[model samples]
Target: MEKQSIEQLQKICTQLRRDVLRMVHAVQSGHPGAPLGCAEFFVSLYFDILRHDPNFNMDGKDEDLFFLSNGHLSAGWYSVLARSGYFPVEELKTFRKINSRLQGHPATEEGLPGIRVASGSLGQGLSVALGAAQAKKLNGDDKLVYILLGDGELQEGQVWEAAMYAAHYGVDNLIATIDYNGQQIDGPTEKVMDLKNLKAKWEAFGWEVNEIKDGNNLEAVLEGLKKAKSLSGKGKPVMNLLYTEMGYGVDFMVGTHKWHGSPPSDEQLADALGQLEETLGDY
Candidate 1:
């Protein structure tokens, strides 16, 4: 894909938000909150940071690799992948439907052009992304590996184990970002399990840490990503704590955990759609 201006990237982000809302509403199923929350991050990664091939290589021999740890937010990843030219935008209509390649969570059995592994089980993506980074090093690929994880998902012990491995082994080419929306499917993440001092925890684990105060803002996300890239190859992994509202664009859903996995009703969908402009003309 060609390089896009910041204005163009923002436009694509709007379209992606629209796509997430509609896809979840169409199926009356699928998680929408994190996807809506991380729209700008997805837009930033695909359009600006990632050095990937839209042509779809399973091995990704010489390209930057991305892993979606919080796979419930597959809607945003799917929309971005489509918009980034991995697959036809029209394929989004098949999301969550029987026999559709776009499953509720990303899977590889169906041979989706852009997906490399199945995900949805939390606390596994970071390890997988680290493994990919190791493979790249083994092959002398000289590229980065990126992963997206959720704050709530961090309650799983496996996440910390992966953190230890990354730091211990000096996985310098790996970058991970967390969607710190403070909300999860059941309720607030704090109520579920407190992750206080998240930044300090990562720092203690021997990784570089950065923060994005407004993940919904395109400029902020781009700036954070650029900084993360600069921090790479320094003998330590990097993490970006991206603070975001659970449902950013929609008024009623913002900052609440209720929208975490709930599909909006027809009336509610209309209301949400009103908040976003039809940028890129929608998928």
Candidate 2:
């Protein structure tokens, strides 16, 4: 594949970040921090990196997969999926509403085309991705699996179990990214539960690790994702310690643990939107 220009992808990342904030503010509920923090990486993967159709049918036959472990951040995922044409952009308005496909957490059980598993509880996605990776190999398929987790989710024992299993069995087709934004629902991850030496921990687990200087910077994320792609198929699973601001772009939301899972008030929403451009047009 030809390399994508970082400048162009930066514009797209800006739009995706706008979409994430708009969706969350519209619903008056959901997690914005992870989405805001990881927007560039999501844009890098969906628009500029991953190989898959937006109209993906989760048969696990030929498509690459994205698993969202921090399911509360579904607003951003849904926005990106819609903007990327996975489903109609109109669906974004239904987020977190009863009977809406765009639920508070992603679930394939609802026949959502792009999502492969339900992941609101956290920490299970990497294990699920590992299973899919092994299955893909068994089927002679070379498609890759990508999973994103919050830094807090790493505290789950299941994540380490999946980590051990992937390294032991050589699940080289999987790329796991941790949203190292520091803040969680209660407070900063350090205050809530210290995950000291996070990168070193992944390296110790036998995974190849890379760090993105700024997760919110589209150029940097695109470059890091390209590097991650190059490292694929090298007989080691990859983990990225994505360093990002907890709530990026909007000044009121950035660097705060309070916005992790809370909704913006009507006044706050207006204030937040005042700081962003409605690049792709709001849903």
Candidate 3:
């Protein structure tokens, strides 16, 4: 695959961030921090990196598949899926509303185009992603499986169990990224549950780990993802410790957990939107 120009992908990230903020503000509910912080990574995957079909194939034969382990950030994932043509971008308006396929978290019952699993319970996404990766290998498919996780979610024992299993089974086709923003709902993850020496921990679990210094920066995120891809099939599962600000792009929201599940009020929304310039045009 050819290297994608960073400038073009940056433009896409800007629009995705806008979609995230708008979706949350619309319902006055949902998570904005993770989505905002993770804007570049999502844009990089959908537009510049992943070999996926937005035409929406559930089985996803011979194509890369992604799962949102930290599903509360559905705002970001839904927007990217829609803008990428998995569904109509306008449907983003239904976010968090009753009877909308775009629920508070990614779900399967509604048969949402991009969601393969109903996530957001956290600590279980890696296991599901690994299952898909193993299935791909068994079916003689070389495609990869990707899952995004939250740092705070890692506190769950299931996450570690899945981590150990992936390494034990040599799930080399799987790439799991942690949203290491340091903040969860209550406060800083360290204060909540410190994951000291995270890289060493993953390495100890027998997985190859890659670190992205500035996950919010498009270039760093793209490079880290490409490196992880290159390291695939090398004999171990890959983990990306992607460090990002809790609330990125939005000035007031950045670096705090306050916005984790809090949507902005009318006045705050106006201020937030002003900071995030329209890139691909609002939905």
**Top model number, lDDT:** 1
Q: What are the root-mean-square deviations of the candidates from the true structure over C-alphas?
A: 0.8, 1.7, 1.3
Q: What TM-score would candidate 2 get against the native? A: 0.95
| Candidate 1: segments with Cα more than 4 A from true spot | none
**How does candidate 3 score on lDDT?**
0.91
lDDT string, candidate 3, 17-104, tens digits = 8888888988888999999999999989998778988888999999999999999989999988998889999999999899999988
The list of candidate 3 runs beyond 4 A from truth reads: 1-4
Sorted on lDDT, best first, the list reads: 1, 3, 2
Clashes of each: 0, 0, 0
lDDT of 2 by residue, 36-128 (tens): 888887878888778888767776677778888889888888877887888998888888788988888998877776898898987899998
* Cα lDDT listed for each candidate: 0.93, 0.84, 0.91
Candidate 3 lDDT for residue 86: 94
Preferred candidate (lDDT higher): 1 or 2: 1
- Please list all clashing residue pairs in model 2, or write none if there are none: none
Considering lDDT, which of the candidate structures 2 and 3 is the better prediction for this target? Answer: 3
